[model samples]
Structures are given as structure tokens and as C-alpha cells.
Target: MAKAIQKITLDRSEDIPFDKLELSQKNVRNIKAGVSIEDLANDIALRGLLMSLNVRPVLGDNDEETGRYEVPAGGRRYRALELLIKQKRMAKTEPIPCIVKRGASTSVEDDSLAENVHRLQLHPLDQFRAFQTLHLQGLGEEEMAARYFVSVSTVRQRLRLASVSPRLLDLYANDEMKLEQVMAFSITNDHVRQEQVWDTVSRSHVREPYYIRRLLTEAAVRAADRRAVYVGVEAYEAAGGVVMRDLFEQDQGGWLQDPALLEQLVFEKLKTDAEALKAEEGWKWVDAAIDFPYGHASGLRRFYGERTELSADELARYDEVKAQYDKLDADYAKAEDYSEETETRLEELGNELDRLNDRPHVFDLEEVARGGVFVSLDASGELKIERGFVRPEDEPAGEVDDADDGDNDGNVGVATSVTGGISVNGKPVAVETQEEEDDKIRPLSDRVIEDLTAARTIALRNALASDPIMAFVAALHAFVLKTFFLYGSDSCLEVTMQSAKFGQTQGLGDTVGAKEIEQRHEAWGHDLPKTPAELWDYLVALDEASRQALFAHCVSLSLNAVVQPWNRRPAAIAHAEQLARSIGFDMVDAGWTPTVDNYLGRVTKAHILQAVREAKGEQSAQLIDHLKKPDMAREAARLLEGSGWLPEPLRLAVDETPAVQSNDDAAELVGDNVVEGADADLPAFLAEDADSEDAASEGAEVEEHRHLDPAE
Candidate 1:
């Protein structure tokens, strides 16, 4: 027969008066934790006590029960009740529920410890669903937050988590997915899309929270994007555009889902703004776009507008500030050190007077009639209107030759020329010129001009299509036009090349590639002529090497291999691979390392281990494998330094043949083998911890094996 099972006896519970329940010193909880006493009291006062207090009868000196109980386990709940009585919300005689411990073998401290330790906090998924349940039961977010004593945002965050794809929720519930990953999935409400992203990241070695967010919002425009800021999120939503938000993390103003609509709205708004600006400022022509290429202002005649005269009040203020500023400046320069307050005051006074002096700019009437405007969004997303740019064709007449005048003597009349600039002190100085009636050249009739140009245009097209050399040159001309002109419609051929803009990609501007491009762009900008009209002649005059270099730069800027969700390009990416292979490109050689910030921190702990195992060895990986994900990543980064361990995305295909993987070798990703030369592989912090006995033991173990240094 099986051993007879012992019957269990639970402590009896009773409704004891609040006044009779006394606090016990044997309670183990002395430190404060979650949910403040005041908030808990308020909660209890609102909802009444949910859990009963665990108490035992207070014994006198005679070992007889006193007419009172002492709480041991539910001290916090007891305090909550006491607080309600103190606040006069609950009466002293109010009966409180209590679980009576009668003649228990366990000590009061043991009971208290068991109550807190043996209990399980509610699972995150359960808590999320609880909020959802309360919401479905007609409770508002504020109402639920009030009931739980949490903030409204906290309740909403939980609700958002609960509202995630039910499949993902189930995974979270089953502990198959992390809460952070679940939060990332909550950015979008499209269940199908959410599940799809989950499926995609689930297979990848790195599924960090941020990476998940990036993958989900790849096609969407960031709310901080110039276009999104120009077209406010409210207007985008009003126009039926979806904005995906992350309640758990800062989304950098969130993401606008409807990119097509956003683009359309941005374009329409920019065009409207340009039209309004042109009407207000009397500009001849206005070209509006989301962005002009890098060297758009090249080859244009830029004229600064005149500042309006200051008002009397502004003038007085400027004078007052300037007097104070001048005195302060003299004192500051004479003093050995300046106070922060003094420095700040000087800056303030200077800025104030500067603002007063820098009045609104107004273009001249003649400039307004002859010049044009380029309208677009600036880096900060405000409407940027660049005015008073005179195109080559719109420039005023140059010096008139006396040979053109039939009645003039053979005398060269030295008149000022507006078309050409004179170098004075190495700077181009502008001299205003007046037009002469004799110098004006009359145009032919429109029909006659069209007839002459039509023949030339048709013949040119035929000539370009036949000669590959000229065709290349013509294509190069269009690329230059597109790359350097705000309105690049100069080309007769329909060929277009639009460089990908990466304004929203954080830190991209600071990248090695970006810096090199900027340097090259600035060099070319300094060398190029004043206007796009002269760009063709300049290109034609360049040597073959110079032309090829410029050509390569223009073509390189147009190359975009970014993988976007809405803009999938398998063939293009493959073509990029072919190009890379031809050039023998390597991201490692390009100066990319698996630092904690860029690679290791963005991947899962397993991926970090896998990388270390591959680059170093199983033994080297195991040294840091037992650490937390963040710590592991940092150490792995150090271990893999100069090891050239590239992620799959950065890896180039050396051949068409697929390399085989090993199952048995993969199983040794985190083994306990001694790392040979592991002293060199371990980080300084880990190895130099002389005070840590654990570190000493690890260091000794590392010394046993000498040839498994991860960095090597």
C-alpha cells in the first residue's frame, strides 16, 4: 500500500475589528517596495480590502489569549486599513477580514517570510489582459488607472500591449516572446503585418526591441521627418493617414504609415506655400520640392535681400542693449575670468540687439520680377523659402558694344555690366547696371524659333541614340542636371537619377561614407562654375580622368541598396552584391566593427554568443556566455575586436555555392572548454578584478588553454 497521505489543516479566518488588530514586530518586511502606502490606502478605501490579513491571537503573561490580534503576514494590508481609519474614511469599529493562525508550528517571522516569498506576482501578460478586460467592461483608461493606482499612460501601455496581435499575445503569454519585443509589435495595429514582422525577426539572430521597431516602420515616414513635421500628424490623421505609435518607448515622434499620402500632402502643401510666397514676394517663377539634391545652389546668382528699417522702439532697444553690451564686453576682456551670469547677460544683450538689427528681408522690385524662388523643407521641417535666385537666362544685359549702334563713333563706352562680377580683394563685387535700348536684341517669332529648334532637337536625339559616346555624355549631362539643379528639366532625354535622402536615419550623417561624400561634394562645389547653364561646358572642358571622377561620384550618390518594407528590391540588392563583388568590397575594411552600440547590443544574447563562438572559439565564448545580455554583448564586442565577425546582412557572397552549416559544431556555441590565450581575449575590467575570487578562478581556467584567444 502507498504511504498514507497526511491531511492538511488551514488556519481559520475571522472578521476582526480594525481597532483590535495590532501590528506585529515579527513581520519580515521592513523595506518599502511597490505601491506607496497612501496610494494603497486610497485603493483600499475605494475598492475595500481584497486580500485578508494573516494574524494570531495576542497572549498575555499568563499564556492566555488577549482580546486582540497581531498581524504577521499581511502587514502592508494592515497598514492600509490603519491609514483608512486615520483618514476617517473607515470607522475604528469597522470589521477587517483576517486569517487566524491558531497554535501554528511556524514562527511569526517564518509566516511573514513565506507569505511574501512563496507568492507569485501576476504575469505581465496577465496584467495586460486584466487591463483589457477592465476596458471591455466599460472602464475608461483613467478609471482603470485610478482603480489600480497607476498612471493613465501605464494603463494605456498595458492596453496597447494587450491589443497586440493575439498570436503574439499568446506567444508572450506562453513566454515565447519578450515583453519588449511585444511592445515593439504594438507600434502597429495591423495584426497581419505585426505577425509577419514577428515571423521575420523570430528567425533572425538579433531581434532586439529597436531592431523590431525599425523593421516594422521601414516603409513608414518618421513623424520627425521634414515632410511629416510640415504636414502635422493631426492633419495626416485627418487626411486618413495612419500614424503608428509606441506607447512603451519613445518613437522619435512616431511613424507616419501612409507615406504615399504624406508625400502627396507634402508636395501639395509645398506647392501651395510656394505659390503663396511668389504672390506675396512677386517672384517670377517658383519651384517647390521635398528636397533639392546636395549641390542644388551651385551655378545660381544669389542676391541677399535688403533688411527693413527698424521701428523707433526697436531702435531705442538696440541702442540701449548695444551700450550695455559694449561696456560688458570691455569689462569681460579686461577681467581674468568672467562670471557665468555676466557671460550669459552679454550673450543675451548681443542676441537682442542682433535680432533688432536683423529685420525682415525684402527683395527689390526689379529682383522680384527677374529672380525666382526654390521652396522646400529645411532640416527642422519648417517651410524653407529661398528667394532672389536669378537664373542664367533671366540675368540682366551685359556691356553694350558700340559696333551694334549705327550712329555711334568707334568709341568703347565703359558701362557697368550686371552680368559679370569683378574680383576686388579676391571677392566678386557686384556693380549695378542699367539696360541700353541699342544693346537689346530682339527675339524671332515663336513659330520661326520653334521650327528651327524642332529640327535641331530631332536631329540631336537621332544623333545621341546612334553614337554611344555622345549618348554616355548626354546621360552624364542629365545626371549633372539632376544632381546639381533644383529644377533639373534641362535634359532632352528622359533619363533621371534621384539620390536617396537619409535625413531621418539617425547618425547616418556622421558615418564614414557620409563624411567622404560630403568632402568630395564640397571639393566639387568649390571647383564648379557659378550656374547650371555653364555646367555642360565645364564638363566638356574637363579632362577624361576628371570627367570620369565626377561621373563616378554622381553615379555613386544614386546607388541605394536600402531594404525597405514597401520598396522590396531583391534583384536590385542582388545587383548591388554583384557590384560589390566586382569592387571586392568589405564592410570590415570599410571600418565597421561589432561594437556594443552598433551590432552586439542590437542582437540577442544567443547571437552575441554565436558571434563570439564563431570568431574566437567555444571556450572563449563560454567565458562571457553566463553574463547578462548587455554585459555579454559588451564583453563579446571586446573579444571579437579585430576578429572581423560580420552579420549576415553585411556579409558578401564570395561565390554562388551555398556554404554548409554543422549541427554538432553549432551545439558547442557555449561550452566549458578552457580558452587558450583567453587572458588576451578577456576585457580589462574582467581580468583586472583582483578582488573578485570568481574572476581569479576564471582567469586561472583561461590560463590552462593557450591557443583560443577570441581576439586573435
Candidate 2:
């Protein structure tokens, strides 16, 4: 036809006995890849020759037929067949379907290369759908994994991915969605919710798997939460509460789907447990709550019962342990360096001694009967039973012991107890003494003592002021005694140090700053003098360096930068600002930053917007202002994080010109410009919105002026 097209004939295909086939050395695949031989063999056994092997007839040097074939392409399949035959699962002479390539024009290497390289892999979505079908058709995950030569987890993950909304699955199939994103959607069974979350995340800038999970579980309670831990997952499930889990990641416990049901179970279980404790401990009343806020026991009187007396056996064991500990400790001290065996023995002995010393207190039967207990869950989810709490109204009336039983007072007769009288200042003193009013020596009344102490303190202050060195030393002494001593001190110079105790601020105890403050306090307390009277002498003996260190610590304790909502002391706050400027106290250096739980999330929308606008930009603030309060707060926190922006109250007071960038300088200036009881500093947008509202509402807003310092 045009030069007469050559008649084309395809390779002949036929079934050849497995025993007649031989391996070809010309095969291009020298290195192992893709599925293993064992898995391929299993797959072949289960599905049986899905693809035909390519074979060429063997030829001798003379170019004559040898009645045998060599496989070039499909080498893995040929190996799998050989394995099946070796295992006796298939007959050696069994017919194997194959395509025979003939003629010298076509090379075995070319065929092998084409066979290996031209193949296309099955799409992941197709695999997922097929696995899902198999699962729906009553195939177990393990069986499917074995049949497909994959891990059981892989099979489960594929199935989970397929179970999401068909729309999302379609998107995944169409290559518009990531596998991880699809896996995130597989966490929930609600198809509608999966689609909704997808819609939201698809349009959002942050479409990571974690963000998807967060949005889905925004309303759900974490399994690690106090309430969830209190009611365990098994119990929650038993109570018909569903838990959503991520099979693709380590979801630290997972999310409880039904918060209502979880809370219900938690409260019910807590109530039942509380009742059991009440019955066991014989408490007059039992108060149970999910959370008992810090200082909940402020007004409640806490009394300790006498420690239970040790039995003879226990006392003997304690003595033995104590003796061993003492010997080991002394030996270790004598050694220049620690010996492993000796140190270990000392530690063991010390632990044993401590165990012996930790004997439980034995409360009086009457007290136990009248007192109550607080039943709650600790951070570790264990039952925290605070016992022996006697309410003020429930206290028993005082009973007077018989006065005439002894000498009207509970005292031993001096004449019977003493052999000789004591002398003071060369004057002999009577064994029996009584307080008597006299001109030279009279017992000072309480009021007189107070007045005298007040006068002495004034004189001391004046004298100390005149002598700076002495004043510093005295201040340092008072600080050291207060910090290191556990017992009440009678130090003439009283330096009132305030612990960073939170009252109006919620969640303050859980802050990092609070923990550091507490640790510092404890460390100082361990080194301070225990007795108040000895405190003055100890300070006097301390070196100048130690005195300076103590002075700094005491002055730091009196620093108050807290901006409470109800109590807004302008003069005090202004002075605190001035102090900050003087000391160069940088809040950023203290590691304080904007966070959802710390600052941004607890403030108003206006404040959050202001923070973002200041820290990030006006555009960043606008991006989050349209969201709901909680969402906006969370986003604002993200934008403002690490920006080193501080509220007006937390900023340093500016003096003259700043030597650095003026981010904090602006805050200081704004703070200085603020007028008391006026909305003079309100943002233009806020002011505009306020004008549209009623006058009464505006007045209310003015009265409830927000603190410039966001002390969350």
C-alpha cells in the first residue's frame, strides 16, 4: 500500500510447563526493589498469575531449539512460581501461562527493560477503595493485609481513610487533597462535620493535619484532662460516651466525643466515691467537687492529729535502720570520694529510715467524728482526700479541767522540784516568783509594749537612715531571717515580704513564673535563720556581700506590679512604673509572652485587636477580628507570640529619650496620657462603636475600665 506495509505478527503466547523454564542472566533488574519475593509468592498463591511472564526459547551455539525457555521480564513472578513449586504447593510440571518472544530482532534485555520500566503503579485511592470493599465484604484487617502483602496497620489506615465523607474521598481520589489531610478527616464518623471542617481548613492558611484535628475537637474534652482521667476511658465507653481516635498518629489519649456524657460520668463517679470515703472515714460531712480552687481552704481551720505511737516491733526496726543509716553516712563523709556500694547502702538505709518515720497520724475519735473531708481529684487523677478539717461552727466547746486537782495551775511545786535557788546579777531569786507591780520593775501591759516597740522602731529607723551601711545590714538581716527561717522571728527590724499570692487572677498558680518564684522562695527559706531572736545576730555577723544579696532579695519581694481589676491604685501603679524604669526591669527578659491561656485569650476583643495591631500589624489584627471571641483570641495570641509587646501597666516608664526601639516606649507614653475615669484613650473604632450605643451603657463601660496590664 504505500511501500507495502510489512505484515506484523505479535509474539506467540502459550502455556509452558514450570519445569521447562530457566532463569535468564540478561535480566536488567539486578537489585532488589518493590515487594519482596516472599510477599510476591504469597500474593501469587492467593491471586494466582495475575500477569503473564515473558519467556524466550533457549538456543545453543549452533542456533537449534533446546526444548527449554528462559524468562527475562517478570523475573520476580517467575521466582514466586519457582518458590510455590519448591514448597510443593504447585506441581513442577504445572503449566505456566507466558508470552514467547521470538526472532533475533528483539533482544531479551530490551523486553525486560520495557516490562519493568513501562508499568504504572495503582493509585492510592484505588487501593484504599479496594481495601474498603474487601473490609465491607467481611474480610478482617489481618486477612486483608496477608492477602495484599501489607501490614495490618496499613490496611486499617486505608480503610479509615476510605470511611470519610465521600466528597473528601473524591477530592483525595482526584489528587486535590493530601493523604495526611484525608487521614485527619478519618478521625470523625460524622460525614457532614468532616466536610464542614474540610471546607473551613481548605480556605484557611493553616491546613495542617493538627489544625484539622484541633478544629474537629475544639468542643471535645481531651482524654488527658482531669475530668476525663478521673472517669477513665474504659468507664466512659461503658457509659456510652464515644472517643475519637487518630490511627495515623500518636494522639496522646484521644478526644472524648461527648463532653456532656463524660462530665456526667465524672460527677457521678466522684459522688459515689465521696460517699464511700465518708462512710469509711466517719466524716460529719463530705464535700465533693471536680475542682477545688486554690485558697478554697482559706477560712477552714486545718488541725493535725497526734502521730500514732509506734509498736515495739516498729520501734526496733526504726532503731536498726537509723543506726545503719548513721554508720553509712559517717563512713561516706570520711571517704574523700563516694564509693558506689557505700552511697547506695546509705541511700537505701536513709529511705528505710524515712519510711519508718512517715507513720500516719492518729486523730482523736471525737475529732474524726466531728470533722469533714474534701474529696477531689489531684493532677495525677488520684483521689485527694483532705481530712481533719473542722468547720468554725462545728468546733467543740472548751472544757475546763479540775483546777483544785493540783495547785490550781498545771505546775509542779518549785520546792519539791529544785535543790537550790538561782541568783541573777548577784541577787538571790526565790524559787517561787510572782509578777508584782513596782516603780522600778513592773510587767509592761500589751499596749505599753506596743508603744515602746513603735518608739524604738522610729529611733532605729532614724539612726539607720543616718548610717547607710548599718541600715543595709539591718534590712539584709531581716530579709535573711524571714526568707530562711520557718519559725516566727522576733527581729526588731520587720521587713514585710509578700509571697506572689494570687487572689483575683485566675489560673495564676499554674504559671511558669509562679513555679519559679515558689522554687526561689523555698531555696531561700532552707538557708534562713529559724529563730527570730537569733536573726538579728546572724545578720550582724554576715559579710557585706551576703548583706547586699539579702537586701536585693527582700526588696524584690516588696515589688508589686500586679494590676488587679477591682483595685486600681493609680499612684501606686505609677510609682511601680517609675521603679521599673529605674531598675530596667524588662518583662521580656523574664520570659513573659502573649499566650492564649496567659494574656490574649483572657482579654476583650478590643484589647486583643490592639495587641495584634501593635505586635504584628493592622492587617494581622483585621485578619482575626472577624472571628468569634475565642477564635479571635487564639489567633491573636499566635500573631502576638514572641513579639515582646507588653501592656501599659507592664511597660517601663519612659524617662528622657529611649536608647532603643520604642515599642514599650509607646505603651509608657500611652499610660502617662491616660485620664482617670475617662475613655480618652479608647481606639477610634471602639469609640465610634460606643457612640452608636446608649448613654447608660457608655457610662457603665466607663465605670468598668479595663486594666492596661493584662495579668491573666
Candidate 3:
């Protein structure tokens, strides 16, 4: 009882002449899509016909073959062949490969729809690997680009993606990572590091491409950094240095792998340039550095020279250019829109005017011989040469004062050193006598004023710090003055805080806090208006929340908790303490604790013991008192790990408005946690005193006491 299966006949295929093949009207493709007909023709010309056309025989009314074929599925290929024939690349009489379908059950429309819908495109990863293979097969990037009709940059990107770590490629192939994330990994070739970064970012909430790049380039120097810019990438590469580039995104200038080498090149070039400048300018000295601090020239006396006189021809040219510039500017300002030609001409005229005005200064030969230039890089990475600076040590001594010579008539003779300024009416004013000048107080020197003001500012800061309400009000006052007042006030204590510069510290720029601050500053600066006149309105238009946040950031920048050996600033230190107390600010919360590297190793044994005694009790302090300084410090650090202890300078004074506590809570928050019980097993160091009555009583009370640890 088995059912019989019916057999089906297949359609026949045959070759037909190119001239005999006609386009099918039943084809479903009406509009143009992927791969233009022109491109298809070129492809067919390069690598003959890869696909045979699906054709059905056209029959006459007699039901016989018409010796002609009609293409349905391969319409594009037919058109390409026809195009090639028209271009004389192929003959109309040439035989064309065709699959002839002589059945009526399956329509040409069905065949055409199936052919277009059933085809699959290659995966991106596969395409990347294919490009890599082609590159390995001796096909140049430009050639591949030409063959595929893609840009050279696109080809490069695919190659870069293919060059990523094998693990990353596997991840991409397995659909474990996104294509953009994989592109980020292509920035570096180190498989281990790539895997490490991937593992890290895979768990982070933000797995953006930029964050990945940031993490990878954390230790690397930016190509736009002053050192890297000074030493061109070409030179760095020529000297065997490597650079990590991002092909998918704009990386500005990419990342330099070898910062040390770049720095070395920068210094060497700077030194050579400095020497050249010194020799050419006949300077006393040429101090060269990659950068000079904010106040590098604070103590130096600067003298500017007169600009050299211009020749008659130069003067005429300058006047002509200035006139042209003024006319063009006025015209442009009056117009609703600027004309390209006028703008270009204005720029040219401006440049010419600058060229005529930017004449070299003519310094006195004697002053030039005594002064020197400070050569460094500016913020924009350009050579900044500050000339005509005379150090105090290099200044010529003043003439010694002598007793005023008197004539026999008993009248005092004026010294030649006497000098006076001319009156507004042109007559020389009488010089004041020494006695009269002594009676009238003279203005203090700049250095002295700075020192004294620095002291007063510190005292005021201390007073402000002790009162948080006052600090807040002062910040608001400062903001209001800056926003509403057009001119500066007479008050000497204006809280104009700027970022602190670590003049002596090396690698200060590499610190985490410094980088964060710089990035935030740049972000804010980019959003701010360029014109100072527009700034007040812009700030006023901002929301209240944004204004407060900006105010807080600006105020926080003014907080000076720094301690230096040479620059004591005792009042500032005191202010820092008061501020800490006012805000309940704990250094431990700010990622600092007693450690051998930062604190313990640097302090004495006695100091360590005292700290332990204050943190832990007397018994705990005695336990490590006998050890050497190093051992004591290490032991003290372990015992005081979470004890909320601070050094003297960092300690806050007692808060006047201290939190009120209950009797039980006061006892609990007094010191180290102490249990109300007899002494448990004591350490060997304290065993000798374990039998003492005082120790027993103290142990019972110490056991019940507890205090909050800032480290917690």
C-alpha cells in the first residue's frame, strides 16, 4: 500500500547570439538600484561574464522557436552586454551564455523576483578580511579602491579594521562586539592590551567609542601636544618612533606612542634653536625650555624697545594698504552679506598692512648686551621668544650717594643725582628736598606690596573659611561685581581666583586632577562667547542652576590647600583647616591616607607614636613605640589605617557650632571603640603592664568607646 511519486521535468538551457537576445517586458526591476549599469559593464569587461542570463525562447504564432531569447532575471547583465557591444568591446554576433526556460508554469516575473530577493550580501567582517587578503595578494590600496569603486580612505579603514587584534576580530565575527567598537580597537595592535581594554569597557556603563580611545591613549602623548607638534610626526617616524592612528574617526593629529622620544627631540631642537638665536642676536644668555610657568618672569625687569623707522616706500605701501582695508571693511560692514572678492581683497590688504607694521625693534646696544631672551613654547605650540629681560643679578649697580657738598656761604648744593618730572605747561618742576620727601611716605615697591597683600589675603581667607555663610556671600558678591560692575573696585581683596601653577613640580600636567580640570575648562571655554562685551549678557541669559554650578567651580578653584617649604603662607594653611572643618571635609575622603610613601615614612618615630596614641589608645601606642622608625611608621600606618587621624597642619580647629550629642553618643564618639569589659588577651608588648590596676580599668572603659573613621 505505497503511494507512487510523480516525476517532474526540468527546464532546458542553451546559448544564444547577443543580437538574438532581447530584454523581457515581464522583468520586475523597473527602477535602478545597486551597481550601476556602467559599472556592471566595466566589471564584465574586466572579468568576462560570470553569470549566465535566464532566458526563455520567444515563439512565433506557429508554436515554433523564433531563434531569439528573452532575458528576465539577468536584465542588468543583458543591458551591460549590450552596452559593451555598443562600445565596440564586444560583437553583436558573439554567442552569449543563457539558461533557456521553456515552461509556462513558472513565469519570468517569478524568476526575476526570486533572483533579486534570495541573494545574500556579505558580512562586514568578511568584507574586511577579503580586503585584507587582497592587500596581502600584492594589490595596492589605490588599485583595490579603483577596482571596487571606493575611496582610498575607505579602503584604508577596512584594512585598519582587518588589522585589529585577532581576538577582537573573532569577537566581531561572533557578534559579541559592535563594528564601531571594533573600529576603536583598531587604534592599537597589541592583542593583550586590546583584550584588556575590551574587558574593562565591556563592564562599564559607557562603552562609547570616545571613552575607549581615551583609555587606550591615556599614557600616550597627543600629536597636537607642543612637544609632538614641535617635532613633526614625519621626523618622529624617521627616528624610528611609532604612532597610533584612528582611521574611523577624526583624531585631530593621532597619538604619539613614544612621548619620551618626542620630548627628547623637542628639547634638542629647542636647544639648537636657542643657540642659533643667541649667536644671531648677540644675547648674554638664551634660556630655552619646553614651557615657562605662569609667573616665570615675575621678578625679572622687562624693557621694551622702540620700533625701527620705516622707509618712504614702506610708509607709502602701508598707507595704501590701510586705505584699501578701511574701504573694504566699511563696505562689508554696510552690506547685508559679504562679497567673496571684497573679503579676499580685504584679507590681502590686512596682511600687507601687518607686514609693513611688524617691523623689528631697535634696542640700545648696551641694553641688548646686558639683557637676554627667554625662549619657550606658547600655548599654541609656537616659538615664544621674550627678549630684553634683565635679571636683578645682571643689573648695573647705582652710583653711591655722597654728602651734599656745601659752599663757603653755608648753603647746601644740590646733587647731580637730583631729577624731576616736567610740568604739564612744559616747565621743569622743583625737586622736593630730602627732608620733605622723608616726611612724605613713599609708595612701597611692587615686591613688598605683593608680599604684604599676600599676607592680608591669607588672613581674610582664614576669616572667610571659618564662616561658610560668609564664604558663600563673598563668592556671590564677587560674581555680582564681575557681572554688573564695568570698572574695578578700590577694594584690594578681590577674589579673582585662577588655576594654581606648580612651577617646580615635574609631571604636574600628567596628574589626573590637572587633566580633568583642563578638559572641563576647555569644554566651558568652547561654549562661552568670544567677545568680552557679550559675556555679561550671555552669563545673565544662562539658567540659575547653570550659573550656580559655574560659580561653585570658579570658587573651588580659589581654594589653596598647598604647603611649600619656601613659601610658608601660614595664614593660608590655617584658612585651609578652618574650611575643612566648615565643610566637614576629610582628607581621607579625598583619596589620601597615612601611608609610608606619603606620610609615615617621612615622619619621626615619636610623631608616629603620638599619632597612634591619639588614634588608638595608650596601650596600642606602646605596642609599636620600641620599634625602629621604619618599623614604627609601618606599624603605625596599619593601626591608624581607618582612625580618622590628620597631621597638625591638616587638622581643623574645633567647630564653634559643634553638633550636639547625647551623653551616650558623646562617650561613644570620643575616641577609638572600646569594649566595657576586662582586658582580653593582650599583645606581648603590653603584657608587662596588663597586671597594673590602671591598665585593667582603662581597658574596660576603652573597650566601650567608638568614633567614626573618616576612611570608612
The candidate scoring highest on lDDT is 1
Full-model lDDT for every candidate? 0.66, 0.64, 0.64
lDDT measured at residue 196 in model 2 versus the true structure, 0 to 100: 90
- Give the better candidate number (2 or 3) by TM-score: 2
- lDDT (Cα, tens digit) per residue for candidate 2, span 183-240: 8888889999988988887776668887788788888988888888888999999988
Which candidate number would show the highest TM-score if scored against the true structure?
2
Looking at model 1, residue 416 earns an lDDT score of 13
- The TM-scores, one per candidate, come to 0.56, 0.68, 0.58
Model 2 has a clash total of 2
The residue-by-residue lDDT of candidate 1 on 102-174, one tens digit each, is: 8899899999999999999999888988889989999998888887888999998999988899999888888
Candidate 3: residue 684 lDDT (0-100) = 21
lDDT of 3 by residue, 1-712 (tens): 9999999876666668899989999999999988889988998998899988888888999989998878898999999999999999999999988878885687789999999899898999999999999999999999998788789999999999998888888988998889989988889877788889888777655477876786788779988887787778899999988899998888887999888888888877877787788778877766676755323443455666667889998888788878878887987899997599987888888888888877887667787787777677755578878787665556687521222112112111111011121001111223322211121222222222232223222333333434445457546645664565433221212366643333333333333344444455444654566457988999999997666656555565465544443333333344444455555554444433566644566545655777898889999988776665655676688788888886644444444434787888667733333212111222121112223236666585344222211111
